[model samples]
Target: MAQSGGEKQGKLDFDESRIDSGIDSYKSISREQDASSDRSQEKEKACVTDERLDSAYVSSSLNVDSLGDIIEQCSISECESATDCEYTEEEVNFLTTVTEDGDTILHLAVIHEEECFARQLIDLFSPELMDIQNNLYQTPLHLATYLNLPSVVKGLVKKRVSLELQDQDGNTPLHVACEQGFWDCANEMIHNASPSKLSCVLEAQNWRGLTCLHVATLRKHHRLMRLLLKNGVDLNLQEGTSGKTALHVAVELHDAPAVNMLLNKGANVDAAMFNGCTALHLAVGRQDATIANLLCQAGADKMIRNMEDETALDLADGNDDILALFPFDDIQIMGRTVMSFS
Candidate 1:
């Protein structure tokens, strides 16, 4: 049974050769698998690039369609008289998307005074775009106020469009209505807006810390001023930065009507400004003798001084008539009191 040692060793060598051949076969399979993995990764990358290209193409085509639609709409006069053509729901929806400055169809329709288009837009797209803000942070209500379209403003308010919406400067629709002197739009806002919402409108300050009253006074809009004052706006409210009251602005603007309105509304005639200058001082320094007489008649103190301690007479610059308005006892005119000036 014991074979020769050389024959047994030869059998062992043959078994080792078989094991080495199996190992070489496994290595070749692993190399092929790695190459296949690389090819699959390349195919995935190609797919991503193709998808991006397809997206670009689709976007380009949509842009072309949008431009073409705008051009066609401009050239055609059929839409001018909205009664001539009835817009389908789909067509109205499309118009809603092609907005100028991010405004919806309802916004443009109301602004352009297109009564028929506005009605159709409200009937169809109001639920979708009623709350949309244009690029200028103006809602349809704000636009309506700016354009003095009371009908559209009423319709939007009746539909319960947001009255509390703010623009970029945090101004409400009422602010726009008041600033533009649109009494009808202002009335609509005041009537339909809630008490809390109205508070925001009345108190809402622009970037200049000016409430609606401040704007009305600056523009010398007497009607708007009366409307705001009647609506409970503070008559003596001072600007946050300038500490100037509506009376001060009225005096500066030389608007006799606005000044009288403010004075009658119980505005402080002698309220000092940021620099400690009163309306009387401004009226005198600017040579507004008429406003000066009004201020004096309203009991504005002639001795009111600025931060530099200069009185209204000090600012009169030798105007004898202006110097005579102040009681000589109250004002030191040329180092003398009323005894010398009169």
Candidate 2:
């Protein structure tokens, strides 16, 4: 199924005009499923509760799979049944039990995409359980967003789970979603987020000092890039470690389309990175005529120099097409100072 006639992330080739309706339907399915699943769960809650087999409990980072298997086993009976009988203190404790790597049962549920069991756990546990951070410092909400499970995402959101909490690497759920190309999840996180959360989550950076936009660009997620831009992200924001703007990434990767899109969206064509390398310099160096043309068309200043004091013209080498974007006489102009320049 195509979404907008464009092949975005291998999803349906849908038409841009249909985007609103398509997303509306897409989101509607998630909501409808959640509602029906909730009602079905209500019916099960009235029935008998299944006890976790003793084999289901374990305490080992190496044994997470074993725990995941046991929980998968329990999910079969518990998630489908409506038994209201709550978890025993010991079972609850087991639910909260963390491996050396710090994953709770809730984390596993989201990982396995066991939506029913996950929601049931959410219903039965204290709100604090949702906030439990694993060894990676990812809360259940983070796991759900990273895993791109809408049901689990909504379950956490329904509880008003904290959205602004940063992981060990300093990424909020928004960063995880954007970085991983989970567009729908990103939308859900942003749409449901409070204004304060929107600010913090959008601005939050990972260890590399990359906002969600940087990751989106680095990963070539066109749709995600638009979503972030539509949400009012700072386009000129450079990577903390690399000091490269999104345009620099597109040009370096030889992604002409991304270069065009970023330029249209207001990415500074002449913006420099950590080494002071601008997109124009990268485009010329890469011999990407299309991107070089796009940059020129967008009014990229060919006169800008990197820290190495090299302009796009100086690095064009034998690529006459790239060399042509500059003024015809610029070479002669640079020649007078070329010896002193390099």
Candidate 3:
């Protein structure tokens, strides 16, 4: 049966103007036209009538036998046509069916911020159904995390959905939370996770070879970093491309505070990249004296060489301040040690 032309509570119109409203709603608020203006009143009434007629036509033509038939025709119908339909056995079946885009009703519920409906769907759907990925390869939990929907995130987490499920970017739901700096969502997911499972997720690297900690550092989400660290995320986990640890990334970004935080968290001060260049090598290469000093204070080995056989001292040739961070006497000592070894 077609949903009525009159609006249902919390149901949004799916007209062209509002087709992408679920995502656009977060971007900005649309200005309302002055109601007292005669032209505005006439335009509003016309829009309402057009929408109702369009919805009625689509609903009349909607054939429910095939999976896409109902949704394809109804996509232009009122939002309630699909979401707030009568709870018949057929409607229940449609709720369970995966749409052509790979979305379940659960995914739509999260997208629309239909909290009460989403919670009811969560209870009705099994963990497996909740984990269904759409064409974008995002699960409802992934969408919830991305959209910063904490209550929905909590509901999904409580349902024990697979947090390890990675989206197209290889970002697990937790990775998405950290990437987007959604602290509440990350907190809910982590707190609800078992210790062993949490460990796996904390270490799960994305396609960029970045773990949740790496993502937090890249995004400059200090609070999220602390949260992951507190939950036992490895500070020294490296990215796949360059094998740069969070400290390496921080140093490269010249984020003194992040470097300091990672240091205090016991990140290996001299962790080297895949190229055999330590974080100190990066600091010296960039000639960042403050970071060089910080690394030296943290006991970064000065004599470490990269694949290019360039020591942090070798890279610090022209910058006196950075060179001074490694004492002249220390350079002589390092030189003699190399001489002796050679």
Candidate 4:
């Protein structure tokens, strides 16, 4: 393999041609252009880590009998003594290593939650290490967020890990934090991120048609919901293929806090789903009187009909208390009066 030495086999991975500054692509994976889809098979018998590269060197240049000397020096405890643990001149050439899945040591360390181990490696390595992608195309930040490891999340952020890398599902770590309701992790990202990164997180739609705000609301995570609102997410952004806003989701879940928060934030209560059922209709149909009353107080259109031309009152089965709250005669007059004023 040394006979075929070129950029990948014998050069620094971060040569001038490789590292594009201010960009957020994975691993600075300009390294990707060098590989075929079969790179995994190609890398199989090659020097995997510097550990293996040293072994290959010892076996080829000296003798296999000296292999134990290299192993004993590579230990964490042994590495504490600088003179005892220093790599040979050849070993330093392959210092950075990758797992079979294309994850750097940082990716593996964060995934396995080796806090002290990962921190030591991170402090020694460049922040660029955090940006490396695994076979799944998830950076350490994405993995850390998925695992809800806030310490790792903060450590990477402090190191200036690129916040923009997405997994195959188009989820940034901030998106994962919000979707998983990892509020502290999400908060760290929100407060610490660059304005552009924060905006990206705020507007990113996941595979499920949920932005971070929609996920927070759907999960009824009140603190996260308030945080998103304070940061100014579009309150009425319709979610999913069904065109349901966060308010619609809250109504169906009978989540009064989310419903009230959304209403107070000026979400359009009459915004209909694909079936033309307004928030009021959902609240009544689901028989959540507290949520229905909250919506009504927020000025939900009581007489707003579905595509079937059936009003929420009409959908109110046997629940006279719900029917009585509608004020059918009064809402008609009030609607007509509002239309006249318009």
**Model 3 residue 195 lDDT?**
86
Q: Write the per-residue lDDT of candidate 4 for residues 193-298, one digit (tens) a residue.
A: 7777677667777777777777888777888889888876888887777888889988888888888888888888889988898999988888888888898888
> Per-residue CA lDDT of candidate 2, range 1-342, in tens?
223354212211112221111111111111112232323454344333223221222212422223333543353233233234334455455656665556676776665456777887787666687888866678888878776787788768777788877887788887888777899888887777777767777777788888888888888999998898888787888878878877887788887787888888887777888887888888888888898899999998888888898988889998877766776533345446333311
Which has the higher TM-score value, candidate number 2 or candidate number 3? 3
Per-residue lDDT for 20-105 in model 1, tens only? Answer: 11111111111122222334444333222111211211111122112222322431233343334444454444555634346565
Clashing pairs in 1: 328-338, 329-338
lDDT of 3 by residue, 1-342 (tens): 444565333332222221221121122222233345334344344222111211211111111112122223232223333334334454456567564556676776565454666776676667888988876688999888877889888988888898898888899999988888999999999999888888899889889899999999999999999999898888888899999999999999999999999999899998889999999999998989999999999998999888999999999879988977876533346446433211
Q: What lDDT, from 0 to 1, does candidate 3 have?
A: 0.73
Over the full model, what C-alpha lDDT does candidate 2 score relative to the true structure?
Answer: 0.68
TM-score of each: 0.64, 0.68, 0.73, 0.66
Q: lDDT, candidate 4, residue 164?
A: 77
Cα deviation in Å at residue 308, candidate 1?
1.7
lDDT of 4: 0.65
User: What lDDT does model 1 reach?
Assistant: 0.65
- Candidate that scores best on lDDT: 3
- By TM-score rank, best first, the candidates go 3, 2, 4, 1
Deviation in Å, model 1, residue 167 alpha carbon: 3.4
The candidate 2 region of ten consecutive residues with least summed lDDT is: 19-28
Q: Weakest 10 consecutive residues, lDDT, candidate 3? A: 53-62
Candidate 4: residue 159 lDDT (0-100): 72
